[model samples]
Target: MAILEVGGLTKHFDIRPGLLGRLLSGKRRQTIKAVDGVSFTLEEGTILGLAGESGCGKSTTCMMIAKLHEPTAGTIRFKGRDIAGLDRAGLRDYRLAVQLIFQDPYESLNPRFTVFDLVAEGPRALGIWSREETARRVLEALSLVGLKPEEYKDRFPHQMSGGERQRVGIACALILEPELVIADEPLSMLDVSIRAGILDLLRDLSARLNFSCIYVSHDLSILSNISERLLVMYLGMAMEIGPTDRVVRNPQHPYARALVEAVPVPDPRYKRPIPAIRGEIARPIDPPPGCRFAARCPQAMDACRRDPAPAMREVGPGHFAACHLLDMDAPDSGTAARAL
Candidate 1:
């Protein structure tokens, strides 16, 4: 059974103008569709990668899943229970079961608190453990993240290196032994040299601890290596989703293809032409009808502009894409699919 399931998850932010502007505009409000109808299922002990460019709603989606942001519509089910409808006690339990790992460790960690206090905050807040028990748990968590509690527990965030601070952030999340972890660009702010170590630690810990994870980032190469499955999102909607290797090698959506092509090759001599995606990303506030990506899609046709947004279609085993070009009934559909 899937450990987490999100269906038609949507979050819209109301752009309320200032008093003067509102008076001039007669109270007209604009809505920014930060996350629109994103749906997916994550199996137990598996990692699902969410990849997209900046302002594409990756962080917003993660925040919604973490219950940091309330959704405008849709359902989030954890182990078959709707999170949105949970009562106070249930919500408290949910908070302990799910945790978020922020992008910037320095910013996320409380400088006022020592490493031991940071890791012990959750359990202490819930009043789930005795004073001595909290200390024991904090030490165990510090050890799990490769930090010796006796040596490092008394130190503040400023005392640690970037890599060590990130490990400390990870330990904070794991101290509660969360069942689901939503990691939002946890490696983006860290040094490149230490990224591999963090990734390895995450992989090892997830395997050993048996917790499901949602890893969000704009780094395609890293996601390809770390995630079991990949979901390519654009303008708050999923463009493609499939096995990591398959989607990285052969993306079905035009947006997904452009993202894959944009990855720089390590060899200086190898010069494959990068497929450039034309046009600026459309504004999310009151976006136009039909396919959101049609304005910039290289393969978009008149039908794409006139028709409603396309639904996800299975193009291969366990691979799905939301593109009008994948209309299987069309005569040229086979040709288009083959081109991908």
Candidate 2:
């Protein structure tokens, strides 16, 4: 069953240049296309890994899904209703169903409150249960993340290790029994030795708890291990999306190929392909017409400069890529399975 669906979702931010910079700059106001026309779906009891560079709109997409940021265009339908249309009261109900596990553990947790108070905050804010109920639920949530309620409940954020702090963050999200979790780099800040354990904990929690997940990470290695599917984002657009094995093994888009090639391999014998990307991303403030990846894509044809949408070619069983190269109709009819 589909738990979350987002279509044509876009977010643009108004950027103002610095005082001295504006004097030298051509435009006073600029638009940052943080997320532009992204679409994807997540089925229940599965994980969708969203991977891209720092400014490629990965975090922006996560925020839109979590309802923390309102989209500039398009619809985000959860369960069935358009959550973007919800009012304050309806949004409260929406928050309980969909939760966000922020990236920074220290910034997300409350230093003033003990673990018990921090974890219980969500249930308490929603007024979902009585004080007794809050305590009971908080205890259960703490245990779910591997912390003993009695041992860790009274400790402050500063007292525990990095992994423990993150567990507290997870406990907070799980307290609401949310159906979906948008974990934005849940382990990005953890110590290297403990990162794998944290990933295992997330996989363990998702299985036993039976909730859908949007696991956002820049690291393809982690996504390959934890996600059921992967979506590659570039300049706020989805370059490719498919089953994890398919996307990682035979990436269709040039941008996706570069990312895969960049992944470090332990074996010296496995020859890595030459990376195909060049130059930094151009400003999204009125970006050039044509494929977002055109400037960076090595296989750029004259038509790519015209800006084409992903034509949905079946690269694998359900794998798809959005590139003009895959979409050109052959002279003879009927090899349609490979249409972009």
Candidate 3:
């Protein structure tokens, strides 16, 4: 079943001129297209990895899904119901079902609170469970994340290790028994040795609890390990999306290919060629109508810059890429391009 569906999701931050600039430009306002026309679906109990470099709007997309940022356009549907149309009570229900895990564990947790208090905060705030039940669940959540309740429940954020603090953060999210968990670069700050354990724990917990997850990261290597499906983004648009193995091994979009090639090979004897991505990232402020990656795409053609951004076209079964090259695969290529 599709647990969450996001279609044509967009967020544009308007840059209104200050007094001096307004006097010069006369009410001119520029818009930053943080996210534009991003679409994807998340299946129940599956992990979908959202990957891109910094400022590609992957984090912004997650934030919009979590309702932290108001989308300028598009629809966010959860369990087949449009979230934008949800009533206050309905929105509250949605919040309980969807939980967000922040990237920085130490900053996310309250330094004054103990592990038990931190884990119990959500349930207490919402009054979801009785006092006894909340306490029991808090302990269980902590234990599930590998923090023994007897040993660590009373420890403050300052007392725990980085890995342990992250475990607490996970516990805080899991305590809600959420249907979907959005983890935004959760392992980015952790040590190499400790990251594997956290990933293993997440996989184990997902299997045991049967919850869907959207794991966002800039590193394709990390996503390759944890996600079942990979969605690659560039300049606030989806460049490619498919099964993890398929996307990692056979990326269709030029941007996605660059990202796959950039992942380091660990073998001592193995040597990988440097990725050929050229040119700097394009500015998001009032960007041109053409493909956002056209400036950097090595395979740039005249049509690529002349035409508007290409819509996602199916290049293979269950694999999609947004590129002018994929138009040949479409039966109604002209119509598809016109639709965009």
lDDT (10s digit) by residue, model 2, range 203-302: 9999989989999988899999999999999898899999998899888888998999889897999998768788887666666677888888888888
Candidate 3 root-mean-square deviation in Å? 3.3
lDDT of 1 by residue, 35-78 (tens): 89999999889999999888889999999989999999999999
TM-score, candidate number 3: 0.93
Q: List the residue pairs that clash in candidate 1.
A: none
Model 3 agreement with the true structure over 1-340: per-residue lDDT tens digits: 9999999999999998688867875668978899999999999899999999888998899999888999999999999999999899998888899999889999999999989999999999999999999999999998899989999999999998899999999999999999999999999998888999998999889889999999999999989999999999999999998889988988889899999998989896988887979766764877777888888988887777875788887666677888888775565653323222
TM-score of each: 0.93, 0.93, 0.93
Query: Scored by Cα lDDT, where does model 3 land?
Result: 0.89
Clashing pairs in 2: 290-307, 311-340, 312-340
Ten contiguous residues with the weakest lDDT in model 2: 331-340
Model 3 misplacement above 4 A: 17-28, 328-340
Candidate 2 accuracy as lDDT = 0.87
